[model samples]
Structures are given as C-alpha cells and as structure tokens.
Target: MTIRIFRPLRVRDFRLLWSGMTISALGDGIYTVALAWQVYDLSNTPTALSVVGVAWFLPQVASVLLAGVIADRVDRRLLMIFADVLRAIAIGVLGVLSVAGELRLWHVWVLVALYGIGNSFFYPAYTALVPQVVSKELLVEAAALRQFVRPLTMRVAGPALGGAIVAGLGAGAAFLIDAASFGASIAALLLMTARPVIRAEGKTMGSVLGDMRDGVRYVLSQRWLSMTLLAVTFAMIFFLGPVFVLMPFVVKNHLQGGAGGLGLVFAAGGVGALVSSLVMAQRGLPRRPLVVVYVAWALAAFALVGYAEADDLWEAVLVSALSVGALVAGQIVWEALLQRCVPSEYLGRVASVDSFVSSGLVPLSLAITGPIAGALGALVTLRWAGVIAGAILLGFLVVLSAATALQPRPDPGRA
Candidate 1:
C-alpha cells in the first residue's frame, strides 16, 4: 500500500514534471511568506495586506475565463512555459528592487498583479495538462502524489524556510529563490514531449468569448459539477479572506509572535495537509468520492472556527492543521473526479471555469475583510465567516446527497 503511492514516479515524464513542480511549489511557499510580511511591514495595517490580496486576485478573475479558452485551444505546455517566464520576470524585478531598498507598497502591488496574471494562464493549463502526461490507470495516484508533494513542499518546508530567510536575511532572498524556481519549471516544460489532445472532428474552435460561454453552459448543465462549484465558491468567499488577511494580525497582536511564528502557523497547516494527502494516496479515492468531498469540506469549515477563537500560538497551529488536512483531502478527490469524468476536449475549459467560479468572489472578499474586521473585530469576523461557510457546505451536502445524478458510476476498467 505504501509503495503503491509512489508508483507514479516510475513514469519518466511525470517524474520530471513532478520534480519541477515540487521545486516551484516550495518557492511559492517561501514567496508567500515574504510577500505577506513585506506588505504588513510597509504599511503596518491589515487593509494594506488586503490590498495585496486584491491585487493578486482581481487580475486573475478578469483573465481566467479567457485563459481557459487559450488552454483548450493551444499547447498547454507552451502556455504554462510562457506563464512561468512572465512570473519569473515579475518576481525577479521585485527581488532586485527589494535588495536595492527601492521597494514600495505600490511596487509590490504591481508585481503581484503581474504574478496573478501569470497564474491566470498557468493554472488551467496545468490542471488540464496533468491527465495528458500520465496513463489513465495512474490518474488517481498522480493526483494524490501531486497533492501530497505540493503542500509538503510549498506549505510545510517552503514557508518554514522562507520565514527563516526573512528573519535572518530579508524578503529579497525569498523573491530571488522564487524567480529561480520559475526558471526550473520552464526548463522542465521545454523538455517534456506530449502531444496535444485533438479536438473532436467537425468541431470548430469558437472565439474566446464564445468558448467561455459554452464552458459556462456546460457546467450549468451538469447537476453535480454546478452544485459542487457553487459550494466551493461560497465557501471560499467566506473562508479565504479571513485566513489570509487576519492571520498575520492574529499572530502579531493576539499571540505576540513575529515572522517565525506566522510561518510556523502556516507550516502547521501544511503538515496537516501532507498527512491527509498521504492517507488519500495510500487508500485511493473514497468509495463515495462526492459524498466524501462535501463532508470533508464541511468538517474543514467547522474546524476553521477554531482559528477565530484561538488564544495561543499552539491553538492556532492545531486548528490550522486540522482545517487544511480536511480541505486537502476533499480537493484531491475532486481533482481526480474531474480528470476521470470530464471530456479531454473540454477539460481545460472546465478546469478554468472551476478556477474562475471558486475564485471569482475572492477579490471582493479580500477587499472588504479588512474594513469589516476593523469594524466588527477580527475575531468576530473570522468566527462568522466559518459559521457561514459551514452552513453553506452542510446545505450543499444535503442537496447533493439527494441528487441521483451525482452518484458514482462504476468503471470496470478502473484499477
């Protein structure tokens, strides 16, 4: 059982892709630590930190639908490589400016916006590309392995290393490392040789807007996919803002901790996610993947309520771990289901819509959370966010349970 989890590594192309993505994830973890700390340091306000979130997500919301169309119509590998190159340039500039002591909050906002643009293109392509690189039998394993390694590196080791470097040196070093990591990912993409999935005969590629509309129509037509996306969108709107915007304040003001403490809290979440990923990798998908997905997410939301009321660093660490573990477990199953069920021609577009819907409201959430927290108090804001998210998930679970269309259909060919 244990050895089977690592079976995906035997595929040479997947091995290279996985290794490169792992390095990139690690760098991203470090980059996140640096970016958040830098923002708070510059303005000493939660609103400023919220601005960072807004800058990153607003661009993504604007372009992600189009990005999905491009992903479906072009070589996903090339799209990913181009996105990486753009991110490398953005991060590299940020690094140079930081080291020269010419960095400003506006500068961070601009660079982060650029990074978000890169992300808009990178994610859909990457999601759609994964299934192409590995055999169908390895789909679940590949997805599990990715979920396991990404959080382990990006969330666990990456944030910890970034925090240390920031404390001992500065944010500049972390930015440089992130830039280099993008270069590594680009190189890996260049080496990969995978043929693009052919479009169905007699199917004409539409304009980007037309393609996006078709994608939206397709998701709405599927009861399970639409409902699942709705649940995720609402959950993220209520959950992500509080965690990203208030966690730093909670660490500094409530716990009286510094960068290292913040990193540890984030790392704790990674630990939990890694553990969950390991379990999923070994066990494979649950017998009832859809039911498990909703239930796990609901549990995760309830666990997040613990974060709102936590009084000490240890309490925060424990709750963060629990929340992330539950979240990641469901996410792994969700990815696998999408890869298994969605048609190859429409996979990129579906993945894009998934990203788009899930993240569409995030910018608004991030933009308002700071003011809401300032008015209502951070603890009150975070607590209510969790409660709302939990309620939404519970509702989703009940509704989905009654939908016969969402029930699992057996695949005799599946391993």
Candidate 2:
C-alpha cells in the first residue's frame, strides 16, 4: 500500500489536537524572535543568551524522568493542559515586564526556567498521547504530521512573524502572542473529548527514581534505539548546540549586524527548515534513517563553518538557511525512527531519555560556547567545533550501523 501522510487526520480527536498544536507553533515562531532580541538587549552579549539557554535546558534535563513518569501515570491530556497553563502564566509575566520596562536579563532567566519546567511536563505527555489518538497503522503518518507542523509553523513562520512583530511593536509584544497561543492551546486540550488509554493503574509500589532507572534500563536494552539515541545525544551536545548558542555572537560581530540581523538569520533558517519538513512529509523517510541523519549532521557542520567564514549578510543568511534545512530534516528521520521502533507503553520514557540526553548537552554547549569563543575567537572556535562534530557523527554512524546489523525488524504483530 502506498503510504498516506495525512491518514492520521481522518480521526476527529487527532484533527483537533493537530490544529491546536499548529496554532501554538505559530505563536512560538513569533516568540523566538522576541526572546532572542530580549536576551541581546538585556546583556549586550551572546553569552547572556547562552546563559538563558542554560537556565531553560537544565530544568528540562532534571525534570524529564519525572515528566515521563507522570505521563505514564496520569491523564496525559490533563497534564498537557496544566503545562500550557504554566507556560501561559510565565510568558504573560514576560509580556507584563516588557510593557513595564522592567524586563531584565534576570527576568528572562526566571521566565526561561519556568518555560523549561513546563516543557519538562509537556513534551513527554505530548509524545505519549499521540499513539493513543490514532491507530497503530497510522502512527507513522501522525508522527510525520507533527514533524511537518512543528517545523513549518512553529519555526518557519514563527521566526518571520516574530521578526515583523519585533520590528514594529518590539519583543514584548511578540511574547504576548506566545502567551495567547498557550492559552489557546489549553482551550484545545480541554476540549479533546476522546478518552486516552491511561497506564500505571494499581501499581504504586515504586519510587520515582526507581521508575526512572527502569526507563533508562529499557532504553539500554534496545539495540538500534539505544544507538540512535547515543548518536543524537552526541550531535545535540557538540554540534547543534554550539551553533545555535554561538550564532548570535556570529550575527553581531562576524556578520556586523544587531537584533534585526539575528532575526533575519533565524527567518532564513526557518525558511529552509520549513521547506525541508514539507519534503519529508511528501516522501517518507529513507529506510536507512541512520545514514540520512549522519549526512545531515555533516552538511550542518559544513554550513556552520560556512557561516563562520561568511563576511557578508547574504552569505550568512544563505548558509544559515541551508544548515537549518539539514538539521530539521535530520530531526524528522530521528523522530520517526523513535516513533516506529519504540513501544507505546515505553514511548514516554524513551522520549524522556531522549530529552534528558539531548537537553543535558545543550547547557554544557551553551556554557562552553561563550568561553571558548572568547578564548579562541568566534569564527576559529566555530570552525573547529564544526569539524570535530562532523567527524564524531560520521564515526558513530558507521559504528552504530555495524553494531545493529544483526537486529531484527520491528514486529508488525505488536503495537
């Protein structure tokens, strides 16, 4: 049978969920431009943004295990609603501060921390809920739909809209849009009338840490899944993290521009990523997702190097867009792989592990990127970071494939 990408939308519950999520993503796009500009204005340093990133990421890493546990034990729909409420309050505060002229770097730090906490609860719940909303046969298609909207609406249109808002009403107004989006999302989740299959009934014999340990153990036992996680972990920690954390610096010093310039780069990247997501939706992922992911990373690294070397705005914009396209395409493959291979009962935990590893490295990269750039000069350090990350990703690709060569295919008999 030919694969139908939009098959998941045939379900009423899923249609509502997907539409709400798309609107939320559009708000997120606007928020990104505002947040980046806000961070820069507060400290006049790229390191400041990195610091905000650290504040956001560390809480996510810390809370992911608990988030997974909650997803498994609670009504995931309610949990998601709760998360959206928290985010709405947090972003609303940011909006208030912006209008009051009281927004400071420390305020951004606090807000980011709140946002991260919400994400910790929100992501695992969201991932775990997808399988429940659609049939097993349509899981891949649902995942693809998610991949399409998130990148295209959230990142692509998001940044461009955010740029325009920032240009007109400034970053604060952009944040208000994000707050409103969260409120809208909560309304959507509350209206999800389909009942979800809840897990962890009558099994209250374990500690949270014990549950977390079990989740980690489960991931370790999966041959292909474990390897994919490791590869992604490495890529996020070393390559993608540094590029994003350092790009603002590259924008200001290397590209000779300010907040507007940074917004342009983000917009360019969103454009490229938006196109890539659309392509992935049309053509299901390559069978060798591992190889595809590795190639994307390599291209991404090369693009970062190109960004570092670019002496003009046009060159930087072009490189930024291409690099983002590679990154988003790689993410689609990775996400689909996980959605396909991991069992639904363990999906939340597996996603939690993925979040833990992926997010853990981001703080480290952010913390390190600034100091390294200061010591080695931004472009030189970025170049080295790119080359080293590319080499590591390629090596892991070969090793992981060889290691998993003996693995069996996912059983169609199981959900």
Candidate 3:
C-alpha cells in the first residue's frame, strides 16, 4: 500500500496544528531574511551580524533545558500559546521601531534574543505534541509532513516574499508580517478540540532537576543516540555559522545579488528541501538509518563547495538548493527515529536534549565565523568549513557502524 504524506492531516487536531505551524514558519522565513539584511544594513560588518546571532542563540541554549522541563509538565497547548504570545509582542515592537526609522542594532539584538527564548519553549512542546495528535500508524507520514512545512512555506515562499518586502517596503514590514502570522498559530491551538495523548500529567516544576537528569541519562545510555547527536553537533559547529552568517556577504559582494537575489538563494534551498520531503512522503524512510542519514547528509558538503565556487547568482542558487535538500532528508529520518524509539513520557525532554546539543555550539560557531570569514573571505571560509563538516559526519558514521551494539536500527515496519 502506498503511504500518503497527508494522512496525518486526516486527524483534526494534527491538521490544525500543522496548518497553524506552517503559517508561523512562513513568518519565520520572512523574519530570517529580514533579520539578515536589516543587521547587514545597520553595521555592514560580518561581526555585527555574528554578534546578533550570538545574542539570539545564547538565550535559546540557556532556556531550552528549562523549556523542556516545563513543556513536559504543562498543558503543551497552553505553553505553546504563551510562547507564541511572547514572541509576537517582541517582534511586533521591533517592527514598529523599524518602521519609525528609530531602530538600532542594539534593539535588533535584544528583540531577537527575546524571540529566541520563546522559540526554546515552543520547540519541545511542539515536538511532543505531534505524537499525541496522530496515531502511531501515521507517524511516518506525519513526520514527512512536518518536514514539509519548512521547505515549502518558510524556505521557499517566505524568503521570496520577504525579499520583495524588504526591497519594496523595508524590513519593518516583514517583521510585522511575522508578528501577525503568530495569530494564525494561536488560533489553531485554541481551535484544537482533541485532548491528544499526553504522558506529562501530574509532573511539576519541583522535579526539574530530576527530570533533566533522567533525560540526560536516557540519551547517554543509548550509544547510538548519543554518538549520532555528537556527530551532528560537531558537523554543525564546522558549517552552521558559515552558512547563515556569510551567505549575505557572498551574495552582495561576489554575486552582485540584491536582497531579492538573496531571498531566491534561500528559496532554492527550500525547494531542495521540499523535493526531499516529497520523496520521503512517496517512499518511506530507508531501512538503513546509518547509510541514509550520514551518507545523504555528507553529500551536502559537495553542494556547499559548489556554492563557494559559484561565480553567479543562479549557480549559487542551484548549490544552495542541493545542500539544504540533502540536509532535510537526513533530518527527516532522524526526527522519525526519535519519535518511534523514545517513549512519549520522555519525548519533550529528549527532543530538548537533541536541540541543546545541536544548538549548543551555534553561538560559538557564529561568533567565530565572522572574524574568520573576515580574515579569509566568505567563499574561502565556506570551502574549508564544508570539507571539515563532511569529514566529521562521515567519520562518525564509519566508526559507529563498526560497533556491534551501537548502531541505530530503523523500525522494520515503517521507517
């Protein structure tokens, strides 16, 4: 029987959740592009943008552990709504200031930091909410659908729209758009009538440390899980900052790209991710987790290399799409693995553990990437980062696959 990617949408609550989140993601996409350019416009230095990234990421890293504990303990729906409300206010204030010609680099940094804290809470709660809304039978399709949201709306359409807005109306308008998008998300959560299955009942704030330790111990006990997480963290450390921080410089300086051009490059990445998600929806995730996840992800290095070498805007677009598509394929598989293998009770915390490790080094990476790219130039730095990232990813896979008891095995039925 063929698996339909939209099967999870048949579930009412999941459908509402997905729809709302999709809109919110579109807003995020707009925010990403607007943020990059707005900061670039303010200081015109890579270090300036990198510092903003640091300010934004540090709060997330600090808040996520506590966010996880809170997510599992509270009504996830309420937690998510509260997070949405907080972010909307922060970004809304930013939008108003930007529109008034009174915005400063410091304002950008502070508001995005606020935005990041809200993001830390929303993520784990949202991850745990998925399994509750859908039956186990539909998890694969649901996972694929979840993967679908970002590439299509956020990466593809959002960037394109943001570029147009930033070019025509200014970054402030884009920020306001993002703030309003949260309303859609809030409405979706409120409209959800289903209780959904939740394992966090009776959990309280008093057990914060105990709950955290349990989550950590569980991840540590699974060699495959822990090792793979480390591999991803190390790989991101090598490449993540370069990808986010240097792209605008590359586009503006080398490719002679305007804001619209930059958005198109981002959209290309989304297109690539969208295509990967479609393939996963049609043919379920691979039986060989090690081969699919690592190998496919490793290929992103080649695309990044191509991006570095691209002499023109279109060439850059092509490579960006290829790299991001490769990334999402690996990510989709990993997310499903976590949902299937981990218990519902630990879902929120484990998801946070994954986020914490993956994101822990991001601020550092962003912090250093600017100075290094300044010294070496954006394209040159990208070439080195790609090679280093690929080596770490593939090296871990080969080493871990050799361990008899440490390899991650996919579910025989769906994954």
Candidate 4:
C-alpha cells in the first residue's frame, strides 16, 4: 500500500507536472498569507479583507465558462502556460509596488482580479489535463499524490515560510517569490507532451455557446452530480467567507497573534491535510466513495465550529488541522470519482461547471461576511455559519446515501 502511493511518480509526464504544481502551490500559500495580511495592515478592517475575496471571485465568475471552452478547444498545457505567464507578471508588478511603498487597496484589488482571471483559465484546463498524462488504473493514486503534495507544500511549508518572510522582511518578498514560482510552472507545462482529449472540430462562435450548454445539460442529466454540486454550492456560500475573511481577525484581535502565529495555524492545518492525503493514498477509496466524501466533509464543517470557539492560537491550530484533514480526504475521493465517471471528451467543461457552481456564491458570501461580523461579532458569525453549513452538509449526506445513482458500481480495476 505504501509503495503504491508513489506509483504515479513513475510516469514521466505526471511527475514533471506534479513537481511544477507543487512548487506553484507553495507560492500560492505564500501569496495568500501576504494578500490577507497586507490588506488588513493597510485598511485595518474586516470589510477591506472581504473586498479582496470579492475582487478575486468576481472575475472568476465571469470568465470561467469561456475558460472551459477554450481549454476543450486547444492544448490545455499551453493554456496553463499562458495563464501562468499572466499571473507571474501581475504578481511581479504587485511586488514592486509593495516594495516601493506605493501600494493601495485598489491596486491590490485590480491585480488580484487579474490573478483571478488567470486562475479561471488555468484551473479547468489543469483539472482536465491530469487524466491525459496518467493511465486510468492510476487515476486514484495520481489524485491522492496531488492532494498530498498540495497541502504539504502550499499549506504547511508555504504559509510557514511566507509568515516568517512577512515578519522579517515584508509581504513584497513573498509576492516576489510567488511570481518566480509561476515561471517554474510554465517550464513544466512546456515540457509536458500530453495531447488534448477534445479538439476544436472547426468550432464557431455559435457552437461555443452550444458546447457550454451541452456541458450544463450533461451535469443536469446526472442526479448524483447535480445534487452533489447543489450541496457544495450552499455549503461554500455559508462557510467560505467566515473562514477566509474572519480568521485573520480572529488571530489578530481575539488571540493577540501576529503573522507568524497565523502562519503556524495554517501550517498546522496543512500537517493534518498531509496526513489525511497519505492515508487516502495508501488506503484508496472506500466501498462507497460518495458516502465517504460527504461524511468526511460534514466532519470538516463540524470542526469549523470548534475553530470558531477556540480561545487561543493552539486551540485554533488544532481545530483547523482536524477540519483540513477531513476536507482533504473527502476531496481526494471526490476528484477520483469525477475523473472516473465523467467522459473524457467533456471533462474540461464538466470540471469548469463544477468549479463555477461550487464557487458561484462565494462573492456574495464575502460581501456579506464583513457586515455580518461587524454586527454579530466574528466568533458568533463564524460559529453560526459553521452550524448552518454542517447542517446543510448532513442533509446532503442523507440524500446522497439514499440515491442509487451515487451508490458504488463495480469497477474491477479499482476494487
């Protein structure tokens, strides 16, 4: 089992892509720390922090469908490279502005919007590209490996290092590091020889919309897929804002912690996620993958309630670790299921719609989280949000459990 966990690494293309993505994930962790702290430091308001989330999500909401279409029509590796180049340039400029002490809230917002746009294009292509590089028998192992590396680098090492850098040097240094990481990712993409599963087929402007509509119809036709997406959308709407917008404030105001403390909290969560990923990589999926996914997600939501009630930094760290561990475990299974079930021809579009729907309400949540926290208090807001999300997820678990569509169908290779 242990040896099998590393099986995906033997594939040259997956290995190179994974290496680049791991480096990129580390930069993302650093960028997240810098962005959150820089916003709070400049404006000293929860609303200001919320604005950053809103700015990033808005462009994603608008551009994701087009991104999905483009991914399906062209070489996904090239699309990812283009996105990385754009992101690298934007972050580089942001680092320069920050170092010059000429940075403003609006400046951050604009650059983040650009970053979000790039992400919108990159993610769908990346998700669809994974199976192309690895054989079907190795899909679960491949996803598990990625889940492991992502948190280990992005969450554990990245945030911890970013925190130290922000404390010792400045956020600008972290941003500069993030910019350089994108170059590594682009190089990896250039080295990949994977071909697109779906080609343009002489695509026209009208056919593009038709393709998107077909994608939507495909999702709707699957009861399990639609229901799972519906549940996730609501859960994200209720959960994401409080966690992202209020956590930094919880560290600074409630716990009297610094950037280093916040970094420690994130790193702890990464450690937990890393452990979960390793376990999943070894154990593989359960008999009922969907059931395990929903139950694990529900546990994660309940853990957030613990986070909201924590009195000190260590308490938050412990709770966050538990939550992240469960979340990552569930996600690994979920990704494997999607890769196995969804047809390769429409995988890019399906994955994009999945992302779009799950994140569709995030901007609204961010917009409201600040005002709600300001009025109700951060702890109260976070606690209640967790409760609501957990309840919703439990309901989803019940529904999915009873649905034959989501039940395990025998896969000779996997089982």
- Which numbered prediction scores highest in TM-score against the true structure? 1
Assess candidate 3 and give its TM-score to the true structure. 0.84
What lDDT tens digits, residue by residue, belong to model 4 across residues 1-415? 2566688899898888988888999999899999988898789999898788789878978898888887777788999998999899989989999989999999999999999999999988888888777776677788888888887676667888899989988998889999999999999988989585553457344488888987888789888888888999988877888888888789878887799888788788888877887788888767788988888888887776786788889998898788889998888888888777776656778788888877887777787999999999988888889888888988987877776766744323321
| Residue 247 local lDDT, model 3 | 73
Give the Å shift of residue 97 in candidate 1: 4.0
TM-score of each: 0.87, 0.82, 0.84, 0.84
Choose 1 or 2, whichever is better by lDDT: 1
lDDT (0 to 1) per candidate: 0.84, 0.77, 0.83, 0.83
User: Which tens-of-lDDT digit does each residue in 1-415 have in candidate 2?
Assistant: 5447677788887887888788888987788788889888888888888788778877878888888877766678888888888888899999889978999888888888888899899888888787677765565567667776776676667887899989999888889989999877887888887455444447453677787787788788876677767776766656755687777788887778788888788778878866776677666757677688778867887676887888888888898889988887877776666666666656778888878877677656766888888898888878888888777777777887777642335534235
**Alpha carbon deviation, residue 385, candidate 3 (Å):** 3.1
Q: Ten-residue segment with the worst summed lDDT in candidate 3?
A: 406-415
Runs with alpha carbons beyond 4 Å of true place in candidate 2: 1-7, 32-54, 93-112, 136-141, 155-177, 193-205, 245-264, 308-315, 405-408, 411-415
State the RMSD for candidate 2: 3.9
After the best TM-score superposition of candidate 1, give how far the Cα of residue 165 lies from its true spot, in angstroms: 4.7
Regions of model 3 farther than 4 Å from truth:
1-3, 33-51, 96-108, 163-174, 194-206, 245-264, 308-316, 370-384, 405-415
Better of 3 and 4 by TM-score: 4
- Give lDDT: candidate 3, residue 253: 84
Ranking by lDDT: 1, 4, 3, 2
